[model samples]
Target: MIQLHSGSVMLQGGVPAPIPAAGSGRDKTMAYQILRRHHRGPWEGQLHLTFDSLISHDITYVGIIQTAKASGLREFPVPYVLTNCHNSLCAVGGTINEDDHAFGLSAAVKYGGNYVPANQAVIHQYAREMMAGCGRMILGSDSHTRYGALGTMGVGEGGPEIVKQLLRNTYDIAAPQVVLVWLTGTPPHGVGPHDVAIALCGAVYGNGFAKNKILEFAGPGVAHLPMDYRIGIDVMTTETACLSSIWQTDDAVAEYLTIHGRPEAYTRLAPEEGACYDAMISIDLSRLEPMAALPFHPSEAVTLRELLHDPGDYLRQVEQRAAEQFGGKATLSLTDQVVDGKLVVQQGIIAGCAGGMYDNIAEAAAILSGGDVGCGPFSLSVYPPSIPVNLELMQNGVQQALLEAGVLFKPCFCGPCFGAGDVPANNALSVRHTTRNFPSREGSKPGDGQLSGVLLMDARSIAATARNHGVVTSAAEVDYPAPAPVRRTFDGGVYGRRVYFGYGKARPEAPLHYGPNIAEWPAIPPLGEELLLQVASVLRDPVTTTDELIPSGETSSYRSNPLKLASFALSRRDPDYVPRARATQALEEARRSGAIPPELQSVQKALSIPDMGRVQIGSVLFANKPGDGSAREQAASCQRVLGGCANLCYEFATKRYRSNCVNWGMLPFTLAEGTDFPGCPGDFLYVPQVREKVTRGDEEFPALLLTDSGIHALTLYLKNTTAEERELLLTGCLMNHYAAQNAAENRR
Candidate 1:
C-alpha cells in the first residue's frame, strides 16, 4: 500500500520524474514557498522564522505566559489563542483546573489575546475554525497541532518556541527536506482515515522515513476525500516524527473555509511545475484495511483481519512486550479477552482532535443506530471536537441516535486521549479511536500492580464492535445504511457566548489573578566554569517518549508549580528517579553553600580536583533515544528543576524535545552509537571548562568518568546548536537570557 523513494524526484505535468541531483536553490516546493514567505531572517543555509499566530491549551499556556511575563512581556506581538481542553474536566485537583481557566481569561484580557473557555472547543478545533488560513504558519505547544489539511502550515514545538514568538524572536532551525506524499485512488468502504494513518505510521515510523521532514500531500486522492477526512489523516502525521505537514488545496478546501465563515482565508495552494522533492512516498488508498495499533505504541499496527485470524500469537507478543516495558511489575494479558476464538474488548472511546471530527462521529452514529450496546462491563462514549460540532450533531439528530443506542456523550476535553479520563478496570482491554495507545496512557498505575491494554481503531469499527456487544467485530462484517450527508451549520454563537476574544484590546492596567496552586518558577543557576554530573537513571528502550519522561494524567494539575511538578518526573517509568535527582540537588546545594558533601569525596580524590568550589554538581539522564512524543516543555523543565544539567543519549527522537532541553539550560549530549556508557547511577562525570567550550561553539568535549571502577575517558557531543541557543544554555534558560538582556537595556 506504500512505497518510499529516497532519490530526488521532480513533479512535472502532475507526475513524478527522476532527477539526477537533489533540490537546488531554484527548486521551490510548496513547503519551500510557504516557508520562504514566513522566513524573516537571512535564509541562506538555515531559517529563522516568525509565525503568523500562536496557540496553547491550558496545560501549556500557563507556563508559557509565565515565562513571557518574567521576560518583561508587555503585550502579545501576534494573535494568540489559549484553549482550556487538556485540564477542562476539573475533577483531578481541587479547584486548580478551574483556576487555570480563570487565569487564562485574565491573561487574555491583560495581554490582548484570545481565550476559549472549557467545553467551548479543543485547541486545534478552535484554531481550525478561526485561526488557520492558506499560506500562513502557526505555532502551538501541543504536538498534534496540524492544520495542513486546511491549507495552513502548522508547526508544533515546545513552549519555549512559543515564548520566543511572544517576545518577537525568531524560530531558528536548519532548513528541513521536503517529502512529497503522493496519494491516489479512493478508499474502500470499511477503511477510515485512521486506518490509512495507521498504515502510513507503520510504514515510516520504525525506519525514520519522514523524520524531521515536511510532508506535502498532493495527487488525485486529495480531490476524492472530504475536508474532514483529509484532516483526520493529516493530524496523525506527528506520529511519523515529521517536522510539519501541508496539503494542496482545491475546491473542497475552499468550500470548508467558506462554510466556516472565512471565505477570504481560502486560496489555491499547489506546488509549481517541476518542483523537486528530496524524497517521495506513494500510497494507494484503495488497498488499505481496517487497522488496529496494539498496545505500547501507535506504530505497532496490523489489519483487523490479520489480528482476528491469529489472536493468540498477537496477544502473547503484546504481553511479552509489556513485560519488558514494566519489568514484570504488573501483568498485561490480552489472552483472557479472547472467548471462543473471538476477541472481546471491555470499553470503546471516540474522542480528541484525531477521532472526534464531525464526519467520523456522524458516520459512527449511523453505524450504531437502533443497535444496543449490551449492559456488561463494555461501554461506549463519544466526544465532539467543539461546541459547534456538538450543536450540529444535536441539530442533525445524530446525538439522539447515539444516546438511544446506550452511547454516552462527553464534553470537549482531551483527557480521554491522555489518561485523565475514561480509565478502565484492572487488566481490561479497551478499543479506542484516539491518538495514542502508549503504555499507561489509559491512566492505570502499573507500579501499583494495575494494568490495562488499549487497541487503537477507527470510530467505525469501534461502533461496529459496540453494536455486536463488544465482540471486536469489524465494520466491514456489519450491514448498516449510510447516513445522508447533512449540511453543517457553523454556530458562531457558541463561541460568542463562552469564548473571550480580546485580541488587539489589551488592558495594561488589568489585575492578574493568581490561585493558591499557581506558583512562580524556581530559580535556575547559570552554567559554571567546570561541570560535575552524576548519572541518575539509564534507559535502554529503543525509543523513549516524553510520556515516560513526565507523565500526563493527574500530574498535569501541578504544571504551573515547577518544583511540585518536578516531583512527579519519571514517577511512572522510573519510580526512584525523583528521589535520586533530589538527593543530587541537596548535594549541589551544599556545594553552593561552600561545603562539599561526603558523597563527592571519592570523586574529588579520583579526579584530583580538590577545589570543589569551581565545579558545579548536578544530575544527568541517559537513554538510547528520548523525546519521541509530546511537545510539553515540562519533559525537560522538570529535570532542570531537580538539578539536572545534562542528558546523554544516542540521539534525540524529535527536534522539539532537544529544543526544550536547550531552552531549559540542559546540555543535550550524545555519545557514539556503539559506545558503551562509562558511568553508572552513583558515578560522576567531570568536564573541565564546559561553559567556555559551549560558548566557543565546540561540538566535542573530552571528559573524565569517575566511578567505583576508577576513572575512564569519555567523549560527548553537542550538535547543531544555534548561537542564541548556546547563549540560552550558558545563561541558565530562555527566560534568564531575556531577563539579562532587559536588565542591561534598563541600565543603558
Candidate 2:
C-alpha cells in the first residue's frame, strides 16, 4: 500500500509521506538553485563543467587510474577516494583481484589520492556518509554518482569522463532543461523507496520524461522524508533516464549531516520565489502500490497484487521477452519455474549501491530477523555496502540476526552486480535487490548454455518472499516492530592501518607499472574517401545497453588492458563480433602499413580493386537503439580498435554514447525512417571529408561508395560540442588533439 500525499512530502523512516506546508505554486529546489548559481553556459545545447570534485569506488578506481596513467596523468588535482568494497571476495579472479588492490594502493600513493581498501564501504554509501555537501558538483565513474538527495549536484559518467576530470578538463554538455518533479502528497504504508523509484521509472522511462534534463524534486512532498530514504529514491533517479536530480534540503538533511559527524557540510537550501520548469511530473504518494519490475528492464513494472493474482499471463509475456532478448535462442525459460500455481524462486540476494543501504537492510532484517530460511535449495545472501557498514551492522546485531535467519552475510563486493557471486543454477530463478537485471548479469551465460534469469525487487519484498519460502510476497504485508539501530562510528583505523592516503600529498615522480596485457591503442587511419563495412553485427533490438556490448565479466580483467578488452567486444550478443571485427582490423592495419592480410585478397579480387595493400576498410555496426547503460567509453573505444568507423543506428539510446562516438573520432550516423540500407556484412559505407564536416559542423553528409554497397549519403549531426571535443574529433582523438594543442602552444 503506497500512496502519495497532496501537501508537503516527507519520509518517515523508509516510507515517504506528506508534511504540511504553506501552498506555493512554484519554488526553486536546492539542486536547481545550485545548478543555476553555477550556470556557465546557455550555449543553447552546450554546458561546460570543471567539476567541483571527482569520486570513484573500488571497482572503478583501478580502471580510471589505469586510463589516467596511460594518458600521462601525474597526480589528482582534487579530492579522490578509491574504495575497495567491490572486490572484497578476493577468491575469484585469483591474484588479479589482489593485484588490482595492490595497484590501487600504489596509484593512490603515486597520484596523491585517498585509498579506502576493500570492505571499507560501498561507493555511493560512503559518499553519502562522508563526501556529499550542499551546493557542490561531483563526477563519478559509476552510473549512480547522484547525491541530489543530499543537496549536492552529482553525475555518473564513463571512466573517460573521470579521466578528463583528472586531467583538469571540463565535462562539456548542453544546458539541460530543469524539470520540477512536484511531489504533493505523502505515500501510504508498505511502500519503500524502491516503490517510488519503480513508479517514477514507469511514468518517465519509455517516454524519456527526464532525459538529459535536470530533475528538481520539489513541492511539499520532499520535506517529509528521512535522509537515507530520500537518498535511496534519489540514487535510483538515473533509471528514470534523468540527467541529474536534487531536492529541497530541510532540518532532516541537516540532522543527517550532523548525525554522520559532518555537520559543517550541511547548508539550508531553497528555490527562488518562482522557479521555471520546462515540464512537471507531480507524483501522488498515496497512489503507489507494491510494485514489481519484471525481467529484462525496469520499465516493465506492475503492481505485485496484480501480478500475483494471475502470474501465468505476465510470466508468459516475460518468457517471450526473454526469447527475444536471447534472439529466439530459447536459452532461458521463465514459465517453467511455475509449480503448484506459484512462481518458485531459488535464490535471494540483497546487494549493491541500491539494496545495501542502511535503512533497507535494517528494515529487511526486522522482517526476517528471527525466521529461518529452511534449507530446501533456497539460499539467502546479504552484502552490506562497506566494511564500516558491515562492522556497524555486526556491532548492532543486524548481522547476527541475519546469520541466525540462515542468511549468508558476505563482505562488500560488486560480484553479484556483475555476475561474480551467488550464481544461480541453470534453469533457476533468482530475485535480487540490486541496480539491474539485464541478461547474463546473474552469472548465467546464455552463450555458454547456462540458463537463469533475475527479477528485480526491493530488499524488503525479497525478504518477505524469502520468509514465505520463495513464493512471491510483499514485505509490506509482514508485521514487525523494528528496534533502534545501535549506531556505530566509522572505524577509519582500518583504512589508516592497512590502506594508503595521499590527501594533499602528490608524487608525480613515481612511475606507473603497466602489465603485459596493457597495450596502447592502435593507430587509427584517417577518414576514408569511401566507406565499406560488412554490417558485422546487426542488432534490431529497440535498445542495446553497454553491458551487452563489451560484457562486464570476461572483460573486467582487461579493463586496465584496453587492447586485451577490445577482443571481447560484443562477446555476449554476437560471439562472432570479435572475429568479424578482427578481420576488419586486419584491413585497417594493412592499409596503414601497406601489408594486407590474406583476407583482403578476396575483396580486391571481387571488386577488381588493386591489391596494392593500401585500401581502407572502415568497419560497420548497426543497432536499432544502442548505448543505454554505463558511461563506459570502451563501448565506443573498443569498436574503434576493431576497425569500426561509424555506427548506423535508427536512434542512440543516450546522449552519453553519442558523446563517446564524437570523442572517439567515430561518425555518429543515423538514417531516416523506412530508409532501407543495403549495406550488409562484406560491404562498407565510407564517409568523405568526415573530419572536415565534423570540424565545420555539417548538417548533412554524403557517403562515398567504396565496397559492394553503393555509396549513399545519410544525415548525421552532433550535439553541442565544446571546442575541445571538436578538436579531438578533427584530430582523430584526444591523444592527437593534445599533441596538436601542445605543438601549437609550443610554436606560439
Candidate 3:
C-alpha cells in the first residue's frame, strides 16, 4: 500500500520522475513557495521565517506569556490565540486551571491577543476554523499543529519559537528537504483517515523516511478525500517526525474555508510542474485496511485482519515490548484479552482533533444508530472537536441518535487525547481514535503497578467494535446503511458568546491575576568557562518521547511552576532521575556558594583544578534518540530547572526538541556514529572553555569522560547552530538573553 523512494525525484507532468536533477538551484516545492513568502532572511541556503500568526494552549500559554513578560514584552506583534483545552477540566489543580484560563483572558486583553474559553474548542480545531489560510504560515506550541489540508503550512514547535515571533525574532533553520506524498486511488467505505495515517506512520516512522522534512500531499487521491478526511491524515504527519506538511488545494479546500466563514482565505496551492523532491512516498489509498497501532507507539501498527489472524503471537510481542519498556515494573497482558480466539476491548473512545471531527462523529453515530453498546465493561464516548461541530451534530440529529444508542456525548475537550479523561481499568484494553497510543499515555501509572493498554483505531471501527459488545470487529464487515451526508452549518454565535476576541485591542492597564500555584522561573546562570556534567540518566531506548521526559495528563497541571514540574521529569521512565538530578543540582548550588560537595572532591582532584569555583557543575542525560513526541517546552525546561546542562544523544528525533534544548540553554551534544560513550550515571564529563567555543561557532569540542577507573577522551559535536542560538546558549536561555538585552537597552 505504500512505497518509499530515497532519491531526488522531479515532478514532471504531475508525476514523480526518478532521475537525478541536472540543475544547480534548489527545486522549489510547494512548501518552499509558502516558506519563501514568509522568509525574512535573504533567499539562500537557510531560511529565517516569521510566521503570519502564532498559537498556544492553556497548558503552554501561561508559561509562554510569563517568559515574554519577563523579557519586556509590550504587546503581541501578531495574532496570538490562546485556547484553554488541555487544562480545561479544572479538576486536578484546585482552581489553578481556571486561574490560568482567567490569566489567559487577561493576557489576551493586556497583550492584544485572542482567547478561546474552556470547552469552546481545542487549539488546532480553532486554528483551523479561524487562523489557517492558503499560502500562509503558522507557528504553534503544540506538535500536532498541522493545518496543511487547508493549504496552510503549520509548524509546531516549542514555546520559545513563538516567543521569538512575539519579540519579532526570526525562526532560523537550514533549508528542509521536501518529500512528495503522491496519493492515488480512492479509499473504500469503512476506511477512515486514521487508517491511512497509521499505515503511513508504520511505513515511514521507524526508518525515518521523512524526518525533519516537509510532506507535500499531491495527486488524484487528494481530490477524493473530504476536507476533514485530509485533516485527519495531515495531523498525524507529526507522528512521522516531519517538520511541516502541506496539501495541494482544490475546490474542496476552498469550500471548507468558505463554509468556515473565511472565503478570502481560500487559494489554490500546488507544486510547479517541474518541482523536485528529495524523497517520495506513494500511497494507494484504496488498498488501505482497518488498522490499529498497539501500545508503546503509533508506528507499531498492523492491519486489524492481520492482528486477528494471529492474535496470540502479535499480543505476545506487545507483552514483551511492554516488559522491556517498563523494566518489569508493571504487567501488561494483551494476550489475556483474547478469549476463545477473539479479542475483546473494555473501552472505546473517539475524541480530540484527530477523531472528533463532524464527519467522524456523524459516521460513528450512524454505525451505532439503533444498536446499543452492550452492558458489560465496554462503554463508548464521543467528543466533538468544537462547539460549532457539536451544534451541527445536534442539528443533524446525530447527537440524539448517539444518545439514544447509549453512547455518551461529551463537550469539546482534549482530555481523552492525552490521558486526562476516560481512562480504562487496570489490565483493561481500550480502543481509541485518538492521536497516540504510547505506553502510560492513557493515565496508567506503571511504576505504581497499575497499567492499561491503548490501541489506536478509527471512529468507525471503534463504533463497530462497540456494536459487537467489546469484541474486536472491523467496520467494513458490518452491514449498515450509510447515513445521508449532513450539510454543516457553522454557529459563530457559540464562539462569540464564550470566546474573548481581544486581538488588536490591548488593555495595558488590565491587572493580571495570578494563582498561588503559578510561580516565576528560577534564576539560571549563564554558561561558564569550564563545565563538569554528571551523567544523571542514560536511556538506551531507540526513541524516547517527550511524554517520558516530563509526562502529560495530571503532571501538566504544574507546568506554570518550574520546580514542582521538574520533580516529575522522567518519573515514569526513570524513577530515580529526579532525585539524581536534584542531587546534582544541590552539588552545583554548593559550588556556586564557594563549597564543593565531598562527592565531587575526587573529580576536582582528578581534573587538577584546585579552585572548583572556575568550573560549573550540572547534570547530563544520554539517550540513543530523544524528543520524539510533544512540542511542549517543559520537556527541556524541566530538565533545565533540574540543573540539566547537556543532552548527549546519537541523534535528535525532531527539530522542535533540539530547538527546545537550545532555547533552554542546554548543550545539545551529539557523538559521532559508532563512537562509544564510556560513561554512566554518577560519572563526570568535563569540557573546558565551552562558552568561548560555543560563541566562536566551533562545532567540535574535545571532552574528557571521567570514570572511577580512569579518564577517557571523547569528541562531541554541536552542529547547525545559528548565531542567535549561540547567544541564547551563552546567555543561559532565551528569557535570560532577552532580559539582559532589555536591561542594556534601559541603560542606553
Q: Assess every candidate by TM-score.
A: 0.99, 0.91, 0.98
- Steric collisions counted per model: 0, 43, 0
Error of 3 at 166 (Å): 0.6
Which residue pairs of candidate 3 clash? none
**What ranking of all candidate models by TM-score puts the best one first?**
1, 3, 2
lDDT of 3 by residue, 1-748 (tens): 9999898888878788886852422355788889888888577778999999999998899899999998888899999999988998898989888888888888999999998999989889999998999999999999999999999999999999999999998999998888899999998879899999999999999999999999999999999998889999999999999999999999998888888899999989888878888889999999999999988788888999998888889889988888888888999888899999999999999998999998888888888877989988899999889989888888889999988888898878988888789989999999999999887788888888888999999998999999888998889888877779767678888887878888799999987889888899999889988899999999988889999998888988888888998999998889899999989999998888877778779888887665677788999999999999999999999999999999999899999999999999999999998998888899999998898899899999899999977999999999988888899999999999999999899999
Tell me how candidate 3 scores on lDDT. 0.90
lDDT tens readout by residue for model 1, 1-748: 8899988889888897779755572246878899999898666878989999999999999999999999989999999999999987787788988898888899999999999988888889999988898999999999999999988999999999999999999999898998899999998886889998999999999999999999999999889899889999999999999999999999988888988889999899998888888889999998888999998888998999999998888999999988998899999988999999999999999998999999898889888888888898889999899989999999999999999999999999888888999998898999998999888888988888989999999998999999988999888777877789888779888788878889999999997788888888889999988999988898888988998899988998988888889998988889888888988989999888978867777678789885788899999999999999899999999999999999999999999999999999999999988999867787788988899999999999898988778889989999888888899989999999999999999999
lDDT of 1: 0.90
Which portions of model 1 show Cα errors greater than 4 Å?
A: 25-27
lDDT of 2 by residue, 92-145 (tens): 555566677777777777889877777767778777777788888888877778
In candidate 3, stretches whose alpha carbon ends up further than 4 angstroms from where it belongs are 22-28
| Error of model 3, residue 109, in angstroms | 0.7
